[model samples]
Target: MAAGQPVVVLPENVKRYMGRDAQRMNILAGRIIAETVRSTLGPKGMDKMLVDDLGDIVVTNDGVTILKEMSVEHPAAKMLIEVAKTQEKEVGDGTTTAVVIAGELLRKAEELLDQNVHPTIVIKGYQLALEKVQEILKEIAVDVKADDKEMLKKIAMTSITGKGAEKAKEKLGDIIVEAVTAVVDENGKIDKDLIKVEKKEGTSVDETELIRGVVIDKERVNPQMPKKVENAKIALLNCPIEVKETETDAKISITDPSKMMEFIEQEEKMLKDMVDEIKASGANVVFCQKGIDDLAQHYLAKAGILAVRRVKKSDIEKLSKATGANIITNIKDLTAEDLGEAGLVSEEKVAGDAMIFVKECKHPKAVTILARGTTEHVVDEVARAIDDAIGVVACTIEDGKIVAGGGAAEIELAMRLRDYADTVSGREQLAVRGFADALEVIPRTLAENAGLDAIEMLVNLRAKHATEGNARYGLNVFSGEVEDMSENGVVEPLRVKTQAIQSATESSEMLLRIDDVIAAEKLSGKEAGGDMGGMGGMGGMGGMM
Candidate 1:
């Protein structure tokens, strides 16, 4: 070693990008991901058809769904995906807006960095701007009520407007609102799981219907059992009605044939006794979580009971919520008090498959939406759209607040953020203004997707927001002009907008702060096969982003 020479400590197999190189790569990765999904924005947005290695196809315009389906490896790109996931988890809508804003924030920050502004100042500016943005959103949001069915329907329609289900937005909107409102508990808390969506192809989207109770994709266990029951008394059983077998294998030594006959009779009698218990409880409808043996089915049929076997555990829980029934673990414990009442329980063949529908409950906390379509892909996409609609409506019901859609919230927020940015001093002011500019991506992308002049629409929107009581004005893609979104019945849950902005800002700030990246290299095939020592697991992540 030469004097005054620094010695290399890092492994020769390691690859590192420092300072400008790391930031540039990270920002470019984010922009690429953002650009990939930017076209799928607004009502006129296009859909993405993703096919995996297994040849399974997914057609969607939902931002989170698209991101989840992609094989993303870049660290920064994955963070943007997380932003979309968080937005979807929190509000169920506005995922695209969140991701687009994050990408634009990074793009704007890149320019500021090129101008020699420090990253810490940029992050601080974004933080301050985030706080102010939240305030502006709250001030502009309109109050909503749980009982306002019309407004709630509008929110649902707004969420479903841009997806594959837009053609049936009116009907789906009503179904979404009804389903969500049906599951709201007395405490005004909504468990989104309580709303179940079942997709069946070979029917038009207009044929979709909402059921006041749960729908299990199972049929009667026996052909002799009743196909339909009126004024149904349901018995939800977790235990099997069949005779219990010994856990350990044992040889059965029969001395005579008559002994075997007696043994068979005894087993039959045990199953009969179990069926008698169910019949005695006045349960005409039975949903079993376990199997029902042939003998047990005969006994149940003889008692004029409708029985379904091998029902899923989750379905059993949903049945309990919908029918107000307590699941009985043992048949011997079942009684009239343990049974649940539904006006009707019937098995119907839908889309050439058997499914049991329990409907007309007094006030079910769980309900099902049967989504129908003409094709498999159409049905899948429609189901996803309904899922998003359900999520947003539930959010509105819980938050009791909404804001005008059609990019109105973003435009108003940008206007307000710019005004606030002028009050700040130093280099942070530029970052605050950058945030304001980044928000315009929503309106601009909306116009671009609609094939309208983005500049003209933005100019009109800004002019509109410049006037009093015009804060709710936004671009109407169909007319190619700015109009009040509220008057056009375009509105969404406040959570969607706020969540998108917050997640976007946070993710962008995190990406902007990254100034270095070190990736470990993988060993060659022969060397890797020799031994595992000195080989780090991070070798698989080499060249990421």
Candidate 2:
């Protein structure tokens, strides 16, 4: 480790074209990522067949998945990848939104910088505008009544279908509504958070069940342990129920008979005492935090108690509840108790589709997202979309409704944004107008993908926009409110509406203020010029892009 001078690896020059600072580089990189994948969100959105520098092809429309595949080396290009990841993590379905919004936002910010707007000023205005968007969200949120089951269906179906799931969209949407309605208390408010969403493949929606009590396939050391427990008094333990002691310190000693005898007596007594304590705690079924001990097991089973051993870490998390004998880890550290339910993982098969459904969980943490399609992969992709929709629903259920699957609502929103641009202030209104324009891509992409003529699709969408009269546009994930869509078959990425707003608002605020391109990348004859080095995760992300 000799250090005369610090290692000064130079940045690739591409960033210089954008700007020298960290912010400028981020803008450049973000633009690359967003523009690269912007057209991959809707049905009409272009599908990218990203082939890596090494000849591997990725084929899909999932933004995170695609970005995961794409290889990017330029520092500027990597910024967009971060934005895409941010979108996925935040909304579960807004990768394209981040790209489109970030791309355009960068372009706008670059212009502002050209016009002598300080990066600081652009950031300030964006912060203010962000608050305004919250107001927009509050106002845009729709209210439904007791008779709004159909309305809910409209939202669900639109969300499912928009993501291109066909076979199970309408059915699952209705099923979701039924599942949600099953647990709604007498109170007028429907806590969407209470319903859990688990994703599975192979089994059709028909074979799903909702259980009153939690059931698991548990086993003890001996096969003779009970397979079933009735009226089970369950104690959810967050520690190992097994009797085996884990390694704590490295040691070797066994010279004296007295020492050996003393150790044996202590361990036996401790095991017996632990078992007695567990049984006396009124727990017939002990869910361990870690593995269980053997002697502790013998006493519990002899006492007619059910002792489970070796639960996977994930299973432990799903079942643990705080503030109960629900044995949480003694250590202060623990996973968040989203609910006392696990996701649906099935090995059953029914026809072509694998059996899939959200299992027994009333907590908002437990949700079964049902998406559909003809093929397994297609269904898988749609299922992924449904999962993203779950998050979007989480964020918006309090104040939003679903639109149609074909980007109909997005187009409407875009139009409105343009119309209202004049009413907004300064360059910010122009940014909002741009947001409206960007939204139209959803429906337009859907129409294009469905094989409709571009101009004709636009006309039809415009006509529908006028007729629908500016109602909220989204999928009815819980109800069967979609029609003509399956036949026409338009799809969007998961959670298009809210995600778009979030990605756009964020990117605009972040990007529009960039002052200059201090550095930039220049691709040259096979190798990208400038020393941006290899982007860690962006390789082969072309499929979704």
Candidate 3:
């Protein structure tokens, strides 16, 4: 009976590809994404100028930024982008390495697939190799403490050396170290968020400086307010200094001119009372997160208290941390204990704009880095570079471990993994060896980008790693010779390497497991109209019946 029955068919608009075809498509997508960012790696790498649909331009070599700016439509390729983002979020640097490694892993897996190795077997080998690499990384990593200023500077400099900030890496590195060090609490907890970066487009990148306290890109609300307040007792207020309207709608109607005058006087008295309360609390400066009425500003100036209105909530929180002050919401609740003391609270002109600087804070737990560059693009890139530096430094402080960079660590791990693969006794061993070869891609890319012979560099690096006490030797891009990366001050946080490997392996495995791809057709206006017409036809047919 079933032989004579009709078979159901999928709609023409729905497309599905399975098995080899699907895997090939996904692998191709992954490879293409990797190739897109491959050229922008290491110090010798070139930058990518990405222009969006609206013609806005972004010139950057940062991996995450480049990937994010690209309008990738493939689902599989997007997964690779996530790998870069995760690496960037976790380690701040090494995003390019992570994406490139993931791509290489997939390329190697494709080779294994061609040789009749099962995807499961290849993935198992990758997992094993990843675990082994982490162990190797830990073995080679050096311990760093909170007070190790020299080592911290090296870590920061290493993170900044390859990017646009390289021209002033040393100076920027010092500022980064000082900013992070100043914000580290006594308990050794380093919060990268406590360090603020402000960028202004007017000077060279080297003009960037670190400030010991918070810097607000705002000025005194009233011109008559003191530009500089010495022995500042800052009051951080969240509530509005303006008289709030009633929560429920109401109206006041005055039948006489005298009544209207009394109403205006009452409002002024309320504003004056708010300012009086702030003065009585012993606060000479006010940072208001909400709006301050004009009357309140007048009274505050008359009282000789400097005030800034509508400050960002984040800035208010930072001011509290930096000044050791409490944020008060209600004027009635304001007290002397809520006031934060600063040696000087001043409004100064920066790049033709007035900026408030709260300086000389006692033992500030938060600080700022004012980054200056000659153009908007330069300043933006410098900010990105500084952010990476801060992130790596914070990660190192938290993890208390560092690794040699410039592909040195990758070479060591690849060698160690190859040796470990020999201990295995199955076809999976080939996959493990494939994983080892994938690790070599990092150094190879570095060599290629630096215009050196990739093959020669790899051979020399392998030979050097085989020798005793030469495990940390890496290709120094400038010298084009293998050198000890650690001694050369090319160091990075251990988390960068570990996270890159972990994310790349996970992304590759996820991609390798995709054997089917089904895409739903996107509806256009014509299709939507046809569907609507079909519905109308059905309605007409019912009416005729």
Candidate 4:
């Protein structure tokens, strides 16, 4: 109330936007991110060619890959990207569907905002809708047993179908199913890390094959070693065969030339003794994680043993699982029980490079899928597709549940959610209906990407879901018509759909609740200069005083 009083000012370097301004900015950012990946939704979806600053180009229709490649700056947009990543990591598929749903949720929330509905109400409605959708998903999901190989194949086919892997979908599907089935333990636990994917560019994608054992991208340590070993008794070593140096610094004084010669002989004898212990353990093939000394290699070759040096730690672990072998770190402690058995281990030339394959393990808990393609990009894309296929198959085996794909699941959920929305009598009901509308974005985007009228497709899909058994009916991207996705072998793991909806809703709700954005001044050279100038002005004033 006082007149002509000094007023305090916020630092010029700090800026803040609140209320509608903040919400609008965030909504715009989320929508832009969704729009960026929208066109890459369905089988007919377009691919994005992302070129980084170094000019590394990544051309893909996979949502996670595209988002990962893009250098996003906006915080809201980054949140949407996280949604895709979580979907990708959780289910290994349905990333685009998740991101698009989140964007649509935000878009719908914006409409509610304009109608004077509070953000909390919108978030609550979204949460309620999410719970209902999850229940509907459980009801719609079909049970799949471990022995249901046909259904498993269909699941793999569905995952591989709409992407770069479509060209070789059937072959890749068979390989993926076989690979996953091979790695499933007796307790029904599937460790996907046991499955190794190796890509070699030269052959067609259809030439891709599954190896029943591990394949090391290396050759025998020495040329004199056997190129192929039958009935391989593999010894996995983590320690080096070479003589290790002392931990502390020390100098050895050579009294004469004869003493130096004796020192060299002693070192060679130690290396030979290490190799002798490996041979005594009855291991015909050696896979060492560390270096093998030159003397040790010579002794190994002399013993007619196949040896691979400097193997990766991951490969070594996979070999242990594949052959039921134990990795021994001490050479003197080697025993026959520590050796892994493979019917055959051979070093073969593949794509002009030498690689060793440990095959014919009786009951391998690990397997390999050697993916071959004509080009590097094709190989990379095929690898991604195979990864998705493996992921879905593994998830299905782990959870024992599957669902029909081709947007059928989305249509059914949308229809049921709308009916559920009617029972709730509040503004939250509107948000529930908004959630239903958001679910339709999947089929809509599918139809739109396939060059069909989205409105017409959604109408037909809704009508089909109205019937009791036609809930699995969805838009077939290939024919641009509604069909029974289950009968057509279009299926996915139940986890994929559940994760997509859950993550998308959660992300959208988080973004919707943000009411303000306060950005600190960036520490750029210009700002630093301005701060220095201000300090200099203060110094001049003090001198004048």
Could you give candidate 4's per-residue lDDT for residues 427-476 as a string of tens digits?
99999999999889999998999899999999989988896556689889
Q: Is candidate 1 or candidate 3 better by lDDT?
A: 1
Q: Is candidate 2 or candidate 3 better by TM-score?
A: 3
lDDT of 1 by residue, 96-142 (tens): 99999999999999999999999999999999999999898889888
Q: Residue 359 lDDT in model 4?
A: 98
TM-scores for all candidates: the values are 0.95, 0.65, 0.95, 0.95
In what order do the candidates fall by lDDT, top score first? 1, 3, 4, 2
Best by lDDT: 1
Better of 2 and 3 by lDDT: 3
lDDT of 3: 0.88
Error of 2 at 24 (Å): 11
lDDT of 2: 0.51
Where in model 3 is the C-alpha error above 4 Å? 1-6, 526-545
TM value for model 1: 0.95
The predicted structure with the larger lDDT, 2 or 4, is 4
Task: Give the CA lDDT, 0 to 100, for residue 195 in model 4.
Answer: 98
Candidate 2 lDDT, 1-545, residue by residue in tens: 58686775555443333343545555656666766676665533555666767775655677777777875655456555676777767655667655665566566666666666666665655555445544554454444443466665555554454344535566666665555554454553444434444434455544333332232334444444554454344455666543445579657588999999998888888777776765665555556656666767777778776556665555444444211224455312222331123233222243443322223333433233333344555555655655554444433343344334545455555555566667777666655554555555555544445555556666655665567664344322223222334233233323454566665666556444454444334444676642432332222223222
